[model samples]
Target: MPLGRLLLITVSLVASTGLASAQHDRADWDRQRARMVEAAIIEAGVTNQRVVSAMRATRRHEFVPLAQRRLAYQDMALPIGASQTISPPFVVAYMTEQLDPQPTDKVLEIGTGSGYQAAVLSPLVADVYTIEIVPSLGKRAAKTLSRLDYDNVHARVGDGYQGWPEAAPFDKIIVTCSPENPPPKLVEQLAEGGRMVIPLGERFQQNLCLMRKVNGELEREPLRATLFVPMTGAAEERREVLPDPERPAIVNGSFDEIADDEMEEPLPAGWHYLRQAEIDAKARPDDPAIAFKNDEPGLPSQALQGFPIDGRRVKRLRVGFAAKGEGIRFGQQASQWPYVVVSYYDERRVWLGDEVIGPLRGSFDWIERSEELPVPASAREAGLRIGLLGAVGKLWLDDVRIAPAGG
Candidate 1:
């Protein structure tokens, strides 16, 4: 045989071998997905046949970071940059099962994170509207989901606290972040027979709570203990902050003591930094108010950290604050609010339980709200949480007062 002929034959053989190897690699990925569903999901008791099938079909590795692809099928959260993470596979399955999605259902997911949860729901439901607070994450995940041909999923970068009102009456809603309590707006958006699965509690300590809407009310049940990043934006801004219980009556409650230099991030002299939610008075980002960009999701940029009442003197307290909005737009005759919440904290500052005062309704006129806060027995200290509780708008605050109920 000629030398040239022999060389050509060797090259042809190598090409064929490479093609076969590529085919095998693709097959292996399918097997890995199958194994993940059976071992990480099905065996763990996620028995919605449709959910199990969706889990089996989704390319888990594709949704993960390049370096972490090998461990994608393993049951654990993976870092996807921007200080965000993808939830573990088992937890995802469990959460999905709890939602009990149907073929005709329209689901809303609060934390878009990696879009894995949305991807999982895409096939099981008719449509999925997912909101991610982190803009970069939302954009990236949307791109990935689109590229992977997830046409049924819709993605947006905004605060999930207000829920998607325009797309109100969702058949089901799922929140990945833990809020102090369920956001009132989300509950209002749930359909007559809808279900919402969310994690409720403090930053480090939280529970995966499930709530079902029946006859215009919520039937809540905490399913399990889970660790999730606290909900950011408005929900985060509204979280309870335990100040030194003995701190005097009201210092800088009038928003007058606000640091002039950092008006955009105005901190009234005595208030503590609980979360970095941007509060603005007017359109100026530098002005001060308990504000939120209605169109955006994630943690608020600034919030007024409240003063804690000494649980020692009395478990309950009286709280009041003045509030108004500048650019807040309410939903179709539906009321939104800026309110105060007083919650108890143990000696270590762990959350015991809380009671909401008034979600002072949104209005142009500065309204003064005063209410009694009933503290639970677990109270060593109680924090006065003040901020807006609505979809999108600018809320202004002045003259916040906290006192022992007896006084």
Candidate 2:
């Protein structure tokens, strides 16, 4: 064979192999994005079509570092460097939908950690002005957004508390980080009758609130209980809801403290997602209990609540709760069954591990269950999740409590 012709054939074969590999990678990413949208965004109940489309279109994997890209579409937040994280896919979708974005709207975003939120909003609105306090994160996010062709997102490294005064009167404003109170400047910059969705409250826990500038005053509506990194810069000066971390325990464990808003769903205070196990007010009339029912064996119904803890002082925890079950059976996985999980987290709020209580199968009238789990030496926070985890049948829980094991 002639040397020239042989070399040409080898080059062609190499190029074809590279092309095939790239195509496969692209296809895999597309499949993952689709699954995330259906399971984490749509099925989780974000109904806005535009929001859904934007979520579907955005390539989340591109926003994170290459090492973290593989886990980008898992419906959970991923670290994006500098003690920050990209908001979970559902959170990004839910907040965007709550803002009620419009094609002609001008949106302002505070805390552009990964710029992923601004990227999602870019196509949904006319413009997006985002601010980030951490210079490194802000610069990286700006570069990512630009490279991804999100031309409408304008990012700057600055304290978000003051907001972008030059671009006042934004049609919609979304704050990704939490503040003890809505930054006054942000509220002022919002256009009249404009909508704003922000998480406001304590340092550890907060309520995702939807606010409207109505007749020169803000009307606040609490959407759900959530946790977000605290807004830095000016917001750090205020310390209103700074509860003592040394004393960490469950609140409203008896499923009491119902919302008074007749227009909204009644969920136990300090908790969110009654859909997982809605409050059965009449089931135990005098003592309300949260109930979970899943006719479909493989679908899980769960609710989570986070509490501040100082693991250094509290080395072990005892979780106690009263639960009743009927026809409880495991789901597709053996690990999925009725149980209460106490998840511990490190100082950075990264999950360490979980101490789960029960597989509570079969039928039972009512019984009290308790278990003790050791806290990791580096743990600083804990979260409690209760429900039938991908299990079939009904489960009711009440009087849930977590305390230092010996105490």
Candidate 3:
């Protein structure tokens, strides 16, 4: 063969191989993503057909950091810089399901982490107004959503606690971050009968709460347990002052009969009790490690424990304590109610299990054995640990207790 002809043939062969490889890469990415959507979204009952389809079509990998691209489809949260996280696929589906958005409804999102949720929301609603306090994340999310042709989403860099006042009356609002209480501005912005799903509590344990505006009143119901980073911005500094002390204490004796006058005493402070039967760590001497502290009411208790935490295996952490405050102050807004804060940790002090249950409102609530929180996959085999980060006010914690699975 002539030299020029032979060279051209070789070049053609290389180009063909390159093209095939690229095609395979693209096909594999699609297949993996589809499997994730099937397992995490569709199987989980995110029944909005349009939302499901859009989630399947959107490439989550593109929104995550390059180092975490491989785990984009995993049913776990991924860090997206600035200490923020792109929520797991299941959480996205779960929260979205709670919204129950309609085709013509306009939605608002409080955290635009990686823009993944907003991207998911964009195609499901007529418009999405999302706010992110982190300037860098907001900018990056905006760019990513725009590049993907999600024009229906308007991403802004600002305080989400303020909500988007200009776009008042959103049909639905979803807050990705947890706040001590639902932002008042958000409630004011909701259209009558519109729903809002927010994670309410301290930075540790949060309750997934759904609220509806009825007759100018915001009615709320606790849905499930969850944990998320605290919402940041000016709202964080906005303190709630107690109402007039002269007024009578508000008491509903129906749930449990405790005198309203008795409820006025500040809870006890700085006490930890361990059950004798559960003290096997004394034999092991170094097995289960524990730590505790006390803070004022409405503050979160910071505690740390380490030993062994089995996945999906239920355990109980009974925190017997009282707060030293005039009484549990329900926020001026109905949403700001005091709740219990719990954290599961591994040996390294990395936050693993975080659960917040609320506005038990100065009542004694025990975390049931069956309700043991799951430690994140990253920290599961590292040895069980727990901590009391902080609390609402000065409270006495006595009989600090823990019960492992089957114990």
Candidate 4:
């Protein structure tokens, strides 16, 4: 055989292999994307078909950093540089559904971190005007949007507090970052009866609020509790609650101070993080309990709270709670079970490790569970998560408490 012919055939084989590999990856991404939408979005209670369709159409992997693409379809947030993160898939779908976007509506998005949210909105709304305070993030997002041919999204770098005045009177608005209160300019720019979904409250504790402008005034409705990076620039200066560590201990762990709004999910106060879990509506008046039900068919339900602990002062801690499970089953992975995890974090909120209790399953009556965990030398805070991690079942919890082990 001629050497040149042999070389050409070898190159052709390599090209075909590369093409097959790329196609295989694309197929895997598509499967993950479908599962994400079904469990994280649909089962998580985002019912708006428009939002669901938009979420299905958008390619989240494209907006994420190259290193994080493999995790793009997961229901958690991933870093996208500039010390920022792309919002979780569930959050993006929830917020977009709250906005009630329409085909002819114009949307203004604040805190365009990775442009994923804008890209999701692009197909649902007529136009999307997004602003990012960070120059680097803004430029990269703009480039990604353009590259993806999200022609309807208009990206710019500026203070979101000022909003896009030239594109005033947006029919819908969504703020990704949390502000202590709604920005005045954004309020003014909203057309009458326009809807806006934003995270509003203190630094670590905030609520996802859905507001509507009516009669030149904003009517606020708290949707659920969430935590987001605080809005910078002017909103930052106006922030009233500075970051401060709370005393180490559980608050409202007995589920006594639960929100009683029948219109919304019953949530317990002091539990800053909640997902698919709520205060038991069926509990007796004298006995309140936190309820964890698998609304997401096969997905895990979680409700957790994080607090600061002085590692230098406190050495070991004891956590106690009573739980009951019904028709519970572990998930496909070993880590998925009905358990309570105490996750430790450093001063910068980097996770150190976790101490867990229970793989509780099957129909069981109330069982008292307790565990004592040593504090990491570098730990500054810890999180208490109570739920079925990746498992599906109904669980009830009560009398959760945390204190110094020997105290």
User: Which candidate's TM-score is highest?
Assistant: 2
> What tens-digit string does per-residue lDDT give for candidate 4 at 143-218?
9999989999999999999999999989999999999999999999999999999999876667788999999999
Predicted candidate 1 versus true structure: per-residue lDDT over 1-407, tens digit per residue: 99999999999999999999989977998998887787668755678898888898888888888877888887655667665678878788889999999999999999898989999999998999999999988999999999999999999999999889998889999998878998999999999989999977655445566799998999977665465666889998998942355542555555545434423334444443223334345523343444444433222222334334455666557778767665554433344444466656565445567677654444577666788767665565444555554335656666678776767
Candidate ranking under TM-score, highest first, comes to: 2, 4, 3, 1
Quote the RMSD, in angstroms, for model 3: 15.8
Q: What would the TM-score be for candidate 3 when compared with the true structure?
A: 0.59
Please report the TM-score between candidate 1 and the true structure.
0.57
Question: After superposition, which runs of candidate 1 have C-alpha atoms over 4 Å from their true positions?
Answer: 1-19, 241-407
lDDT of 4: 0.85
lDDT of 3 by residue, 151-251 (tens): 99999999998899998889999999877888889989999999999987644435677889899778887665455656878656762432221121111
State how far residue 286 of model 2 sits from its true place (Å).
1.6
Clashing pairs in 4: none
Candidate 3 ranges beyond 4 A from true positions: 1-18, 238-407
Alpha carbon lDDT of each predicted model: 0.71, 0.85, 0.61, 0.85
Q: What is the TM-score of each candidate against the true structure?
A: 0.57, 0.93, 0.59, 0.89
Query: Candidate 1, 162: how far from true, in Å?
Result: 2.0
lDDT of 2 at 334: 83
Give the least accurate 10-residue stretch of model 4, judged by summed lDDT: 241-250
* Model 2 clashes, total count: 0
Model 1 scores a C-alpha lDDT of 0.71
